[model samples]
Target chain A: MLFDYVYAVDMAHTAEHGARKAGTRKRADAERNIAAIITAAADSLARDPDASMTDIAKAAGLGRVTLYAHFPSREDLLRSVLAQTIAESTGIIEAVSPDEGQAAEAFARMIRSCWPLLSRFGSLHAAAQRALPAGEVRRRHDQPMAYVERIIARGRAEGAFRTDLPVEWLVTTVYTLLHAAADEAAAGRLATDAAGEILEKTLLAALKPE
Target chain B: MLFDYVYAVDMAHTAEHGARKAGTRKRADAERNIAAIITAAADSLARDPDASMTDIAKAAGLGRVTLYAHFPSREDLLRSVLAQTIAESTGIIEAVSPDEGQAAEAFARMIRSCWPLLSRFGSLHAAAQRALPAGEVRRRHDQPMAYVERIIARGRAEGAFRTDLPVEWLVTTVYTLLHAAADEAAAGRLATDAAGEILEKTLLAALKPE
Candidate 1:
């Protein structure tokens, strides 16, 4: 519910690029520019969010005008990188079947799948909140969160997860833990593997039935 | 801890204002202006992190020259607000005796004390990270975190909490949950009262011996 308020991006987070023609170098160039721009922007913003479009263009090995043509403003470039990150993370959840397994197993699987993405895009996610309103970020995060909701529901049905707390609250707690772990790993305070292991155990323990 | 890396602003977070001789309204005027500046900056930046010093002076009902005299740059103003808030928060946490009670009870009290401050300052914290290097923020947080570490150590000694996972990992997990819950409440995704209750239960559950 907090997400509904803080991350209210429009529901559609993906770029709708048409399929490329196999023989055209032009299409390849378009694809490369988009990828390079997003990657470069994520890295640049991660370091200094105020990094100019020129800095990003230099990082991406593109001309300033070419970068401008692809992304009209610094906000536009950051937005694209953020959306791409969210879409890719949502794609990770889409690969999992929250309904097909024991609630606990699916929960663990989703955590494993989701944590690294959270770590990889940790700075970008923070950038998204700063550049966009809370509402916009909330909506962009909704897709991946829905999968999380489904897993909690399935876990409840299997009587594996406690139901004392509302499902929404439980969901937020798990996310809080994962994000914290990811932050630790990103800062090198905790090893990535150790963060994951600790999260899996603590998250599962917290969700277990009384 | 991620905090060890990102929130270290030196252990002495308290303001050490110099004592002044009585009968000088000038001393009071100077103190009031600094407080007003920090307060105004926090509110304005929470709304828009890019809010200008002029905007902050307007909010504080002071002139631009005065605001500039107090905080030379936008970054200076934001960093001060962050430090003041951290100092106040660390003061809240320092008043509580973490090792004196059952770890779970102390943990709950700490959350009850911390979540609101985290919610109130969430944007300011984000603004600080963007304005300064992560190392500065990390140092500021280290003072409060040392208290949290003591609680976890006590819990482990009492056999009331898990030890397989390092104490540092557990401490970060709790901070993460508080922050995430604070984010939810700040966004109004969850009610403040409900977030507190849910957090208390979940945190306690997670820390219980498996």
Candidate 2:
């Protein structure tokens, strides 16, 4: 219902902003198909990084021909997933708006808010990390990492976080723990709520000054 | 050279005691073959969790017949990897002997000793986790977990660590961070030494009393 309402609004806005662009049904349909395929592939990859082209196609409820039409190869499909991951990660960081409030509280808030997405996207991220070199993955993840680094630097400057470590190390450790929380959840060793709570508490305690 | 010396000594001892068990060249050759295959498979799996049987065979410089002779299927191969992982993890934890020092120091020693092995064998462990159910992985990992948990409990008892959280949560968080450290190393985001130092410092800080 919410999507319908929002999508309806989007359609009206797009129609007004550029009717020629919005009026192209064939182009719009292709765009929708690509989005659906990418979303399905992301879900499949998150479940199993080695998910096959056939599996992805099946998951998307698209024919093999259609999937192949959009993505000529598995690498192409993975590229789309990488793009989605980068965009989603940046969007999540932006939405959390880590610049607000006390740096410590802000950091905790980011962890709490980011846990679900981190865990949900865990496999996709891991898959991307595996497929790409660290340098490439880092480059793609630069914006989000920088956003996190800024918040952590602020926390360190405010004397909330320890001053002994570099901001990169601190941010990396936070991400590592976040990924760990996601692994715990995915492994069913910890429920999402429990994982988030433990992570938030541990990270807050660890990152805070002695 | 070590294996040859050990094998010679074992043969002499067995001849003096009972030769039947140690007398066969075929059996000894089979044992060596199996060991080599497992070691190679571990390496290949660590490099690529979905490493194919043929790829493992090539890595070990063995034939399909020999590889299949040892592990009938991918599941069987993965089961061996899981066993190897369990044994190695247990050995690392036992070697650390978390009972030997102040609980915090013991934890650090454990981290320092385990980091190299953990990062090296990370993909194999991840593959095992994916192959086995969580309960099975936990069961296999229980001994090591218990060892870490014992140290954390001692720390809490001695009032060196926080007491508000359950020991299980503390121990889980520690392993989570360790795995994260391993991930960082594997991803090349942090060098092994740096990852270890950051992880040790951060973990000790987090688990210690406020």
Candidate 3:
């Protein structure tokens, strides 16, 4: 069932790209086919952790040799797909206006804005988490950590949060809850809105004046 | 290296079982081998999520079919090992005698006793969490959750904890922190002892009189 859903989404994405390319008449249909192949390969890989290169090519409606021509190896394809997903999600983060109101409110808004992107790219995130070296994951995570840290510091200065706990600890606590909430939602144990609410309440509790 | 270690341990366990089958002549040898197998399997699985069954059988000096006769699937083997590990850790919880001490002291003692277990089993727990059916996992988890609920209720009754939050919420919060701390320690981001200390402080902060 999961595989079928993912495959359908991949097909839809490919169709959309084909439509755009046909409208532009700039690139050949071959470019559109290659895009579809990459999308299918990524979709298959996401569904099956142990999917082989041949299996991915089959899913992409291409021969194994052709798939290799486009992507030299499984790792190469995986890395390329991951890079594209990361770039797309990064664009979402950049598109959000982070200066809406008080620091806490603005931070929450930013988180809300990013939630859909996170949900859509969850499989990519999981793959990146498992495949990347530990230091690389930490390095990539630093930006979000720094953003939350700054928000907490601002909140403390504004008297919106208690000054007792160190900002780093608060940031860690919030991120931990956020990660937990995301996991629960992804596992379908909790509704996304419920998970978000839990996060909000937990963060508020942690920040409350003592 | 991992495969060899597991094979050696399995061989020891098989020898131990053979001794047990004999007229008590090699009972001690059999016991030692059993212990070795369990230790090896636990250590290897902790390091490699995809440790092979053949390697485990070789480690124990048993045939692959024999190992399957003992454990039907990877999930079954993992669950059996985890259950034993959990039972050993629960001994500490039993020793705490939560009813005999002040609320704060009892809570601290409980944390100290369970901290190591949480740390050691963190990754296994995370994996089992992803594999098991939610209903089955929750059933296995009910006992500990009930125990924690009782402790929180007792604390509230004694005026050591605030009454505003639901006991379920408190239980969830404690469990989340315990798992989070375990993850941090496993990831090498924090010392093992820090899990206990952080749990102590976080619980104290959360439970204080309103």
Is model 3 an incorrect, acceptable, medium or high docking prediction?
incorrect
lDDT for residue B142 in candidate 2, whole number 0-100: 76
B1-210 per-residue lDDT for model 2 (tens digits): 999999999989878666565557668988899898889988987767667899999999999999999889877888877788778877987887789878888888988888888888756765555565434655677778888888898888888899866576677677766765665566566677667778788888889776
Can you give the DockQ of every candidate in the order shown?
0.32, 0.22, 0.11
lDDT tens string, model 1, A36-141? Answer: 9889988776655456788889999999999988888877877788778878888887787766778799889878877777776545555565576544765777
Per-model CA lDDT versus the true structure: 0.74, 0.77, 0.65
lDDT of 1 by residue, B116-181 (tens): 767675456655655665446667777788888888888888888888888888777776676667
Tens digit of per-residue lDDT, candidate 2, span A1-210: 999999999999887869766668768888998999999998987877667889999999989999999899887888888888778767877787789888888877777777777778756755555555334555676777787788888988888888876566677767666765665566566677677777878877777775
Please list the residue runs of candidate 2 whose C-alpha ends up more than 4 Å from where it truly belongs after superposition. A1-23, A41-61, A72-79, A99-102, A119-140, A186-188, A194-197, B1-23, B43-65, B72-78, B99-102, B119-140, B163-169, B186-196
The TM-score ranking, best first, is 1, 2, 3
| Candidate 3 TM-score, true structure as reference | 0.62
Q: Which ten residues in a row have the lowest lDDT in candidate 1 chain A?
A: A10-19
Per residue, candidate 3 scores C-alpha lDDT tens digits across B1-210 of: 999999999999999898777847566665665565566566655544445677667777767776676677867876766677767766778788866667767877888889877787655554554445433444566667676777888888998876765566567677767766665666666677666776677666666655
Q: What's the C-alpha lDDT at position A88 in model 3?
A: 63
lDDT of 3 at B142: 66
On DockQ, the stronger of 1 and 3 is: 1
